[model samples]
Target: MAGLSTPKQKISALIITYNEMGYIEKCIDSVSFADEIIVVDSYSKDGTYEYLMNHPKVKVIQNPFENFTAQKSFTLKQASNDWILFLDADEVVSKALQMEIVETINNPNACEAYWFYRKFMFKNSTLNFSGWQTDKNHRLFRKSKAQFTDRKIVHETLEVDGKSCILKEKLTHYCYKNYEDYKGKMLRYGQLKAKEDFYKEKHFNYVLMLIKPLWKFFNHYILRLGILDGKKGVTICYLNALGVLERYRELKRLEKKNELAYYLVMP
Candidate 1:
């Protein structure tokens, strides 16, 4: 239901990827209409490199693995155009969104950036009523005018200093391949968040750990009507809640070690 400006300017699509073999073809094919395609890969161990090497419109660059925010900032810097759309390997350009993007690029008036809603896909299902429905990300923008603020480690957000517009089309996102990958990602992301919070002196409480997971489940499943998606909703909610639990557990360990053991036990 969001509205703003019409598409009227040329766009350069940019992506920072790693081990995207399963999804790269679709990602590239979806954005073929872009004026330029720039991919900064994090030395993928998979066949992603071979695929891009054969792609005619794509320009690939090699980079060592870095955190999401830093890698994206570096990728944008490598892109050789002004207007850029930041996309992920597992994300697909929907037909409606593609049309809107073409139109927007052809006739951009007063907006420098555009935000789009994501339709996250779990296996073969899309949860419409989950908290994910409110998940809108700033993806398309004038590269020179947008930058990421260094506030977050896991869900790094961007800060833009220009007029913006909201596109109605949803971007298709394949979040995880299976349950195993989901759990592994949760553990890794929890470690990242815990480290960041540790530096900021964010203390942890047992009650907060227990309550936060429950709140996440309630927020995603009940409040967001994830119940509409049936089993998919349940899986998403449960995994997300578990991830939150892991984050708090890791944070607590950090606090205990740094605050209590380091000064007293170690010394």
Candidate 2:
């Protein structure tokens, strides 16, 4: 028999986008159940603007992309309801998760934030391991109790004031479609992280550059049980390790360039 009907609750689904023409429609469709959906676009040159502007169910706010944390924080303030559900342009909300979110928002159970398990997809296959299996992110939270940190240029994290609980359902992440896309994103993220480390005066050591990648591979593939995922797992591990190595390499390049050199008087 079907379970009792879940109580309705007002939820605002917030999405940040930039040139995500391919993924925007599906992402929006998955959260049609939400009370309101707001898209904080970063002024895309592509047709993303045209498509989103036409969607009746979505409200688009074009803003310049400064950083991940700031863009997300701005999106949160646009939400009308106290309950906010944050989603990326390439992520989809499963049917079970939608129901679970509704129920949780209606009946808080003494929690201010809720986390969702994520299953990443690669080459059209659901990657069950390679450190991706255990991935979880805090996406749902009460606006009053949650805040985002601006410490890093990328990989920003959320801080919730009260207790948090994890939901049973999972969210689907379409992280990369092909090798080119993966490589491009890796390079871009590596550069951003390198800049962050450089600005923060983090040490640039040759030994760390060599060993850290190896550690990342072993930690994710061996300790985290990523080997069980086969070729897909190896590929994920390799990319992760490569990302770390490249960051240090980029950091070293920046260090030698010397930011203060621009102000020096040349002979």
In order of appearance, the predictions have TM-scores of 0.88, 0.90
TM-score of 1: 0.88
Across 1-267, the per-residue lDDT of candidate 2 in tens digits comes to 999975566889999998887778889999999999999999988899889999999999999987788899889989999889999998999888888888888883648999889989886788887777678999899999998987877887898999989988999898867777677777777877898898899968999999999999999899888898888778888888888888999999898788557557565
lDDT agreement of model 2 with the native: 0.87
Segments of candidate 2 deviating more than 4 angstroms: 1-8, 108-110, 259-267
Q: Model 1's lDDT to the true fold?
A: 0.83
Candidate 2 — number of clashing residue pairs? 0
lDDT of 2 at 169: 91
Task: Give candidate 2's TM-score.
Answer: 0.90
| lDDT accuracy of residue 191 in candidate 1 | 74
Steric clashes per prediction: 10, 0
* Alpha-carbon deviation at 86 in model 1, angstroms: 0.3
